[model samples]
Structures are given as C-alpha cells and as structure tokens.
Target chain A: MNDKVRNSLFYVGGTAVGFVSGFFGGGGGMLCVPLLQFGGLDAKRAHASALLVILPICIISAAIYIKNGYFDVTAVLCACIGVVLGGIVGATALDKLNGTAVSIIFALLMIAIGIKSVIA
Target chain B: MTPQHVIIIVSALGGVIGGMGMGGGTLLIPLLTLAAGLEQHLAQAINLIAFVPMSVVALVIHKNNGYVSIAKSAPIVGCAAIGAVCGSFLARYAGGYELRASFGAFLIALGLIQMYKAISAVVKKKKASKNKSAQIKVG
Candidate 1:
C-alpha cells in the first residue's frame, strides 16, 4: 500500500481497535496484530507492535474506569505482581513451546468460558 | 486457595500468554469474573490496569529482541485514543450485563477464528514433515 493509503487505513483500523479495547476493556491486541501485519510487520513484530498500541490504550481506558469510580488497589497490586513475574517467564521461554498447541488450548478455554459468559 | 491467590495465579497465567504476544485480557477478564467472582466491569478495569505494567516490560523485551516497529504503530495512536475515549464512555453507560454478554459474543468469534488458524497451522506443519519423509524415502 502507498503511504497515504496505509496511513488512512491505520487511522480507521486503529479507531476500531481502540473501541474494541476500550469497550471490552481488553482484546485490542488481537485486532492490532492483523492490522500491523497489513502494515508490513511480520507475525512476531506485529504481535509486539500490537502491544505498543494496546499499552497506551489500556492506560487511557484504565484511567477512565478509575475516574468513573472503579478502583481496587488490592486487586491491581496482586494482579500486577503476578503478571510481571509471569511475563518474564513467558517472554524468556517464547521460542521453546509448540505455539500451535498453546493457542489451541487457549482457544478451547476461551470458547468454553465465552459460552458460560453469555449464558450466565 | 483464597480469591487473592486465585487472582494472582490467573493473572500470572494471563501474563504468560500476554507476554507471548497474545492479548491476555481476553483470558484474564473472564477468569477474574469466574474464579474471583468479580463483576464484569470491575474485572475489565483490573485487567486494563494490570496490563499496563506488564505491557511496559514486555515492550522493552520485544524492542530488545528487535520485534518492535515504531513506524507502523505511531500513526494509529491518535485515532485509537479518540476511539478509546468514546468506547469507554459507552461502556460506562451500558452497564455490566450488556457489556458482558457482548464480550462473550466477541470472545466466541475470536476463539473460533484463532482455533481454526492454529489447527490449520498444525495440519500444514504435519504435511510438510510428511512430504519431507516421503522425499527421503524416494531418494
């Protein structure tokens, strides 16, 4: 794509991604990954770059949630600590696992909970 | 195990996935609601908040690993911010029940797509290996 076309695409796609991320309070990166790939990044770079987009959007969304009277210091702290440690581990082991297997498992769990979420 | 412990464990699991480049919030939000009994909005907020620090750290790792491309990402930020503001406000008004149901629908769609991709990838890999073995036998 030409620079102008790509830029416009990014702008429009970004808006949709942000809306999904913000409204759902998560899942923006999934949209972002493909969007980045469209912008010419490889899969790994697209995933990483998606994080760049998600990070700031999440910050903004989180702030709005706080301002709207949703604040839980204890939950945030516990989750942060766990996430950081787990992030380090996962990042360290990124190249070792069978990615397909992991994703399949994740998808199954997501589908199961998704059904329950809709029902309950 | 207490709720806090469950929160930590699930967060860690989510983080590990997030660190691997998938969005962890997809898993974390539902897990929080189910395991910790948090309301959907609150759980979403927690996922958003918890994501920040971990994202920062993961970004650094990705950048160091040469997996970050700023040029492709920068153009999207401004529009995304505007979209984020609009979406957040909408969520604040929509209440948790409606949002939760919609989120479930979204998850179902995404999970189905991802599962298809992963399964296809596995099948392709197996085919490739089978082709290689056949070539070896022929030679």
Candidate 2:
C-alpha cells in the first residue's frame, strides 16, 4: 500500500485500538499487533510497536479511571515492580526465540480467558 | 499466598505476557477480579494503571533489541491516545456488566482469529518444506 493509505489506516485502526483498550482497561495489544503487521511491519516490530502504541492510550485511560476514584496505588506499585522484572526477562527471550510457539500458546490462553470472563 | 505475594506474582506474569506482545491487561484484569476478589471495575482500573509502567519497560527492551519503529508507530500513538480517553469515559458510563460482557466478547473474537492465523502459518510452513524436499529429489 502507498504511504498515505497505510498512515491513514494506522491512524484509524489506532483509534479503534485505543477505544478498546480504554473501554476494557486492556487488550489493545491483541488488536494493535495484527493491525501493525497488516500495515507491513514484521511480527516482532508489530509487537514492539503495539506496546508503544498502547503506552499513551493506557496513560489516557488510567487518568480517567483515576479521576473516577478507581486508582489503587498499592496494587499498581506492586504490579509495576513485578512487571518490570518480568518484562526484562520476556523481552530478552523474544530476541532468541521463534515466536510461533509462543503466539499459539498466547492465543489459546486468550481464548480460555475470554470464555471464563464471559461465563464466570 | 499473602496479598502482597499475589500482587507481585500476578504483575510479573502480566509483564511477561505484555513483553511477549500480547496485552497483559486481558490476563491481569481477570486474574485480579476472579482470584484477588477485587471489584470488577477496580480490577480493570488497576490493570490499566499497571500497564503504563509495564509497557514502558517492555518497549524499552524491544527498542534495545531493534524491534521498534518510531516512524511507523507515531501516528497510531496519537490517534489511540484520543480514542483511549473517549473509551475510558464510555466505560464509566456503560457500567460494569456491560463493560465486562463487551470485553469478554472481544477477547473471544480475537482469540479465535489468533488461533486461525497460527494454524495457517503452521500449515504454510509444512507445505513449503515439503515442496523444497520434493524439488531436491527431482534434482
């Protein structure tokens, strides 16, 4: 696709992704990765770019949540600490690994989580 | 486990998933709601807040590994930020039940798509290998 068309699509798709991420409090990456890949990025770049795309959206949504008194400082702090550590490990692993297996496992997990969320 | 322990463990798991390019919020919100006994909205909130830092960490690492494309991602970031603000307000207005149901549905749909993509990729790889072997035999 032409650069103009691709840029427009990304902007539009990004809006949708942001909306979903904000509305649901998460899951933007699921959409963002595929959208980026569709726009011509490789899987690894798509994933990484998805993370960058999500950062701003998360901040915006979290701000809204905080304004509504939904903030949990303690939980957020603890989670941040753990996530930082895990992020290091996972990202490091991503460099050396073939993502196909991991992608499959992740997809299956998402399916299970989706079912459980709806039913339970 | 203690509440503190649970928090740490869940966050770590979320970080790992996020680092892998799957949004951790999907896993984190459910875990907090069902396992930690947090109110649904509150759990979601926590997930969003935690995601900020986690994503930053993951992004940095990905960048270091030469996986990020700034020119490609900038426009999406701008638009997504606007959408996120709107979505957050919408979630607040929609109430918990509606929000949860929508999230559930979204997850199910995405999960199915991912599965199809993975399967197709596997099949394609197998066929390509088979073709290569056949060509070698003919030669």
The numbered model that scores best in lDDT is 1
Report the C-alpha lDDT of model 2 over A20-91, residue by residue, as the tens digit: 888888888888888989877997799888888888888888889889888677777877787788777776
Q: Candidate 1 falls in which docking quality class?
A: medium
Which stretches in model 2 have alpha-carbon errors above 4 Å? A1-8, A92-98, B64-66
lDDT tens readout by residue for model 1, B1-139: 9888988998898888777766777888988887778888889899999888787877888899999899889889888889998998888888777888888888899899999999898889999999999999999
Worst 10 residues of 1 chain B by lDDT: B16-25
Q: Write the per-residue lDDT of candidate 1 for residues A1-120, one digit (tens) a residue.
A: 688987788789999999998998998888999998998889989988888898899999999999998778888888888888878777777789887887898798778878988898
**What TM value does model 1 have?**
0.92
lDDT of 2 at B133: 100
Q: Evaluate every candidate with DockQ and list the scores.
A: 0.75, 0.69
Which pairs of residues collide in candidate 2? none
